[model samples]
Structure formats: structure tokens, C-alpha cells
Target chain A: MLSGKKRGLQSIEFLQAPIISSSASVAGPLESKSSWAEDFDWIMEDYLLGESSWERTETKVLQQVIQIALDKQQLSFEDIEVFLAGDLLDQIISSNYTARELKTPFLGLYGACSTMAEAILIGAMLVEGGFFTRLVAAAGSHHYTAERQFRFPTEQGVQPAPYSQWTATAAGALVLEAQGNGPRVSSITIGRIVDMNQKDANNLGAAMAPAAADTIHRHFLDLNRDSDYYDLVVTGDLGLVGQDLLEELFVQQGVVPKPNISDCGVLLYDGIPEVNAGGSGCGCSACMLCGPLLKKMYRGDLQRLLFVATGALMSPTSTNQGESIPGIAHAVAIEI
Target chain B: MTPDSNEERKKIEEQEYQQLVEQVRPRPNILLNCIWAFIIGGLICTLGQLILDYFRAQGMSMEDAGAMTAVSMIFLGALLTGLGWYDELGKKAGAGSIIPITGFANAIVASAMEYKREGYIFGVGARIFSIAGPTLLFGFVAAVIIGLVKYLTMLW
Candidate 1:
């Protein structure tokens, strides 16, 4: 029912979802010894040395995105009505800090890895519902900062499994405005949490694939549309293992879409050689959407697209309680 | 009177009774605590070493191992936290668990567990950002400030 507006008359059909303008930034990995202690020290020194914490990194990325969008769009901070954001850290620190700087009304969201999509979906709804004219949906992640809080310090020596996805050290932002002439957010498919209690945290790709497939399948069902309509279907940060698992799952469900299915995790690390598999974390999809994908769209590389960001809803306590991990995925359709 | 007195004397008898109290308490086992500390701590470190070896075997550079090790430890810590074993082990060996990289992992998972019952919106979802949240905010602000400082310094 949503359509682009014409220049003359402000028809209801002309009212479309806001356009998204994105930006991103990150700190490089520290150069140090393989010992956990040394690694932690180096990361602490390089990234967290002067800053009070990692949440600042998320704020910095958000700020960068906002700065770029402000410059590109030639808009001021006061023009934005809502700032909806999320991150992987506890308490949604990235959004909070960034909100403080921008001084805009904020809606803090937490969908883990699916945070990017969740923010976008909410922003679109606000615009579609005629609540706000301009909204920003942003998310971010930091490597060393995340490492020190979620894992061991570099000083300790530990081994990572091959299946584990690297948390992308980046943040991305999108400025959505109710402009008539631009790509419109066509449809949104919210996800249900599916828990299967498979405790191989290293193989998160497998753990999350079923949920991703479920969401993707359900989105098509709800929209009653064929998969070939969109030029690309993207999932947030499943890494190589997750991508394979998702393909296999789709096949099992007798819903084989084209090979155009790509993952943000795989795309973000396209040029970065040392990065093992692909990206993970809340920022993975956020960065890709704002960075490469948006750039591609701007360059007229493709047209209609589907973005499904998936998340694993597992807590340390749930894992200990012998509870299975629940996965959720949300899909948003955008067209140029 | 003599007969009555004799009968009265013969009828007299005496008895004594005593009450005793016993206390029950568990004895501290130093050896047991020591064994747990050494065994669990050593095992965690060993697992980390094995991960390092695996990464090396897979042709990852040594430089990358440090980052990889932290990632592995996070997963291990999360697993241990989930299994209800890390806290028990941590209790048995205080510094042993606390000193390792897994401690941070334990903090994250433990904080997450504390808030998990609140549902995704306020529970696990909100808590995931607990420890890392502040760290990220500070890092981002610092980066921007640092960037500004560098820019200003260049101009000067």
C-alpha cells in the first residue's frame, strides 16, 4: 500500500518510508603476543587506554555516522525527530551515549545481532504511522572493548574454534527521512524466538540458521511474494558455517531461493584477509547495511533487497540451566 | 515406732539424671579446595592452549592467536557459566578462575543470568550490555575526542 510521492501533490499513496543514509568506523586489532594477557593489555592500551570503556567506541561510530549523514544530507541535528539505536553491550550504552550527544528523543532497542534490523523496522513503522518525519536507526560494536567485557583479557591464552564468527569491530548508522523520491522500506517481517537448546556456542551459525530460515520462509508466506522479486536476500552475520547451515535448512523446508542469498558477515570482511570467517555481533549487519550495501545502492548496483538480521537468544544462565538457545530473525524489504 | 522407722528407711531410694548437648558442623577441607583450584584452573588454561594449537595448525598467524584466544575464552566462560559449573569452580578456587581471561566471560554471563528472567526486552537483552555497555560508550567518546584532538593538533 506504500508508494512514492509525486513532486506536486502530497497524496497519501505518495507518502513513503524514509530513506536511510549510513556511516561507520572502527579501530584496528592490536599488534601483540598471542598470550591472552598481552592481547588484553594491547587492546586495552590501543582502544580502551584513554576511554573509560568500550561503550564509547559504539558512541564514536554512531557519531561518525551522524556526522556523515548530516554533511551529506545538509541537515542539522534538530531536524531529526527520533534516534532509535541498539548494541551488543549491556544497558544499550552505545545508544545512550550517542543520544546524549545528539540530544534527540531516543528509543533504545536490544535484539542482539538482529539489532540493526530491529532498529530499521521500528524507524520505518514510526515514519509509516505518521509519528515522525526523520528518524535514525543505528548500531555498533568494538573488538577489544567487547573482548575485555565478554571474554578473557588478551593476557590469557585461549583457543577459538574455526566455526566461531569474529565480532566485527565497527558501527553503522542510517538516517531515515520521509522523502518522496528514494528507496522505500516496502515490508517488514518480525521474527519469533525459536529455542532448540543446541549448546555448541562455537557453531552459532548452525544454532541460528534454523531461525533465519524460519523467518525468511515466513516472510515470503506473509507477503505472498516470490523470492525472485528481490535482487538480493541478506542475513546478518551468520559467517560461513551459518550460511551453509541456512542453505541446507532452506532446502529441507522445500523453499530453495536463488544463490543471491548473502550474509553481512561474509561481505564485511571481503577485503580483510586476516579475519577468519566473517562478521558476527550486533554491529555486523549494521555496518554492512550502512557501509557497503548502502554504497552499492547509491551506485545503482541493484534494486529491491531483503535484509534479515538473526540473533541467538542464549544467556549464560539459560545455558547453565540446560535450556536450549532460542534464535530470532527479523526481515525488512527495501526497494530503490 | 522402730518398725515404722525401719519401714520408712527401707522405702527410700535415690536416682541421678544428666543432660548432654552435641554440636554438628562441616569441617573445612583445604586439600579439596586446593585440588579443585589446581585442577579446574589448569584445565581451563590447557583448553586455551589446545585452542591456540588448533588455530596454529589451521595456519592462522601467531599474531592473530591473541585475539582468537580472547574469543575462545569468552565462549568457554559463557559455556562454563551456562553449565552452572563456573561459579562452583570459582567458589572452590577464587583467584584461579578470577585471574584467567575467562573471568571477564564469567562476568558477562553471570550478569546476563542475573537479568535473564526479565524476558528479552529487559532481561537478557538489556543485561547483555551491562558490563560492555559502559566500556563501549567510553571508547566511542574517546575516539571522537581523540579524533578531534588529532585534527586540532594537526592544524596547530
Candidate 2:
């Protein structure tokens, strides 16, 4: 029913699928050491990025990644109609400050960790609905910045719970055009707020699992497709705990996706013990989509891909106030 | 069903999901954490004893030496916290580092350093005691209550 082209309840089958022209990912030094190092366009040697604050560095990383995405396409900021992006920081400052420098008409988003997929989904709809010609969709997160804002100061050295996730220090940007030579945004399943009344902030993977399950379930039902539809189904940042729970949830909902399903949080850090369970933050799925998954599509290793970024929609204040964490997941399908 | 019954069903459902999640949530090993806390905590006390003996050997009284040990331990903790080594030790040591005088110093220094970026007036000055404030408040109240009890018993 959405955009008048869908055969499903909450999806839009883009009449002319917008092409992902170019994508660029930047990683901090810590994340650069991961197995997917080659996927990123730039690996910052330090978290500072020559900036005094981590917030400034995060903004710079996103700004530079957007520029790199444009450069890869041989286009200027003026050529882009709008910039849609978000980050984990409060007020979406990283996206806000970056937009100030880029001087493009900006629409800031705040879907917590779901910002990446949300941006791409909305950008796709706008382009397909004949609102914009080309635009940049991006999301980023800085490890230190997220730490200071969400949990503790960078140097606190507090012993985290075993199931806690590490925030990824990375940024990813994609140039979506009306027509291009890259994988296409075939359709998207907009998700609803799904809260199971879970309240543990440290165990976010558990809190967010049900939401991921709900969205993926509705996506399958809406498309009238089974589990094997996507060659690869990746959820954003639901580490080890959430990954296991999601598979179990699918069984409960009768939406048993194949074992091809993987979580970006688990894959992003590659089982690094320092990260505890796995990686998180907006950058988790953003980098995965722009870096490794998109690369696989280009190489023909993957055809249909489901990128679902799930977010725990609760702030530190709400957590402190003993409110349950509500989770949301948006599923974006890409095909080559 | 009535609205009240519907709300009760939802609450029960939420509790059921929480129980299910609890089964899957990995738990920290209590035995290992306790052992680490004990051993690390003992080492800190030993360090305090060493400091006390050092001051006593310099011809100080037992009370003076005890006070000096507390000062030395607090200073060491503050120094380590400033250099950012206290937190690293705290991670492995757990309550071992947290229960000692050094750990007490760290609670303040860590908060101070964390808020230092927000500027001195509202940041460091106000929040330096943020982590340690509850402990100080309760500890003082407990001391006052004990003092009152002792005085009342003496009068009796």
C-alpha cells in the first residue's frame, strides 16, 4: 500500500529502483585492524583525527566519507540534492555539524542505531516518489564519543557486563541516484516500535532481538516470500546474544530464515574478546552495508540482500529512570 | 475481555518474555569474580600495611602512622587515577580495588576527570563527588547514628 506500488502491507516496490552509485566507509585505528580493513576507503591512524574532541572527529569522519562517496562518483556537493544522515551522539550533532560544513540541504535523522537503514529507506522513497534526483545517505558512530555519552567516560575502565557490546568507531556513506551502475534498492519494509518490556541497558542485544524478529517477520509476510529470499540476511548490531535469540524468534514466528543470516555486530568485530559480545552503534550496519555487503554484491557473491538495522530506542535518562527499552528495526532489500 | 483483564494479560506476557530472555542471557561467573575480588583486595591492604610500617619505622606514632598510610594510599590512588591506571586495575581487581582506600580515591578522581571537560565550575567542582557522593553520605549518617547510640548507652 505504501507509495502505491507495493503488493504488501508495509513495503514499496520501487518502480525504478534507485541505484547505489558509490559508497565509502572510514574506520578508526581500532576498527581498521579488523578483517574487513580492505572494505573501508580510509583507515584513520588515530581516533582524534587531528581534532580536539571525539565529537569533532566523528563529524569529520562522516563529512570526509560523504565527500569520498561523491569523489568516487565524480560529483560535487552541489550536484547532490540533499544529505540525509545521523549518528549516536545527542541531538545528532555529528550529522548536524557535518551538514553545516558540507553546505548541502540537509535532513537530519535520529533513529538511534537504525539511522543507516532508515536513511537509505527514506532516500529511496523520496527518489522513487519523484522528490529528489540524487542524494547522500550516511550514518556514523565513534567509539569514544558513544562511550562518553551512552555509558562511561573513555578512561573509566569500569568492568562491563560480559554480554555488553562495544560501540564501533566507523562511518559509511552511499550516493543514491535515480540511475547508476550499482546494486539497486529493490524494496524496503518499514518497521514498527516493538517493545517486549525488557529493561537491561547493558544487554541491549536481548532487548533489540524481538524488534528485529518482528520486522523481519512482517517483511517476509508482506513480500509473500520465504526465508530463502535473500542470499544474505544481515541485521545491524545485534551481537552474539541477540543473534541467537533472533534465530529462536524466527522459529517461534514461523519465519525461519536460512543459516545465511548473520548479524553485523558479531561480524564487525570478528569475535574480538575486547569487544565482549560484539560491536554496536549506527556505524555497525552502515559500515557493513557500504563496506563488505555491497562489495559482495558487486562481486556477484551475493544477489538479494536484506539489511535490517535494529535500534534500542531508549536514552540513558530513560534507562536511569527504569523505563523499558523499546526496539525498532527497518529492513531494506537490495538487489543487483 | 474487560480492559483490566487485557492489561493483566499484557503484563503476564511481558514477564514471560523476560523470563525467556533471562535463560539466554549469559551470566558472569560469581566464583571467579569473588576470587579475583579477594586476592586483589588483599594486595591493596598489604600495600597499606607496608606504608604504615614505613611511616612507623620513621619514628611516627601508631595513630600518626595509620593516618599517614591512609594519606599515602589515597595519594597513590589519586595519582594512578590521574595517569589512568587505576581504572585498568579496577577492571581486573573488581571490588578488590573498589573496597580499598585507593579505590575510594579513584571514585572521586575518575568522576573529576570525566567531568573536567565540561569546565571547572559545573563540571569538575560539582561532579567530582558524583560517584563517591552516595558512599560519603551513607557512611557519615551511619557514623552519626553509631555515635549517638554509644553516647546514649554511656548515659544509661
Model 2 ranges off by over 4 Å: A1-3, A257-259, B154-156
Candidate 2's DockQ is 0.60
DockQ of 1: 0.01
Per-residue lDDT for B1-156 in model 2, tens only? Answer: 899999899888678778878888889878888898899899989989989889999999999999999999999999988998988887787788888988888888877887776899899998877777888999999999999999999999
Candidate 2, residues A1-336, lDDT tens digits: the string is 234677577777788999999998888787777898898888999989788778889999999889998999899989989999999988999999999988889999988889999999999998988899999999999998888788876555477888999899998999998987999999899989888898899999988999998888888888888878888889998989999888888877777545368999988889465778888999888988898889889888899999999999899899999999999999999999
Q: Report, for every candidate in turn, its global Cα lDDT versus the true structure.
A: 0.68, 0.88
TM-score of chain B of each: 0.58, 0.93
Which number leads on DockQ? 2
Q: What is the interface RMSD of candidate 2, in Å?
A: 1.6
Question: What is the DockQ for all candidates, taken in turn?
Answer: 0.01, 0.60
- Name the weakest run of 10 consecutive residues (lDDT summed) in model 2 chain B: B13-22
**Per-residue lDDT for B91 in model 1?**
52
Model 2, residue A211: what's the lDDT?
A: 91
Which run of 10 residues does model 2 chain A get worst, by summed lDDT? A1-10
Candidate 1, residue A305: Cα displacement in angstroms equals 1.2
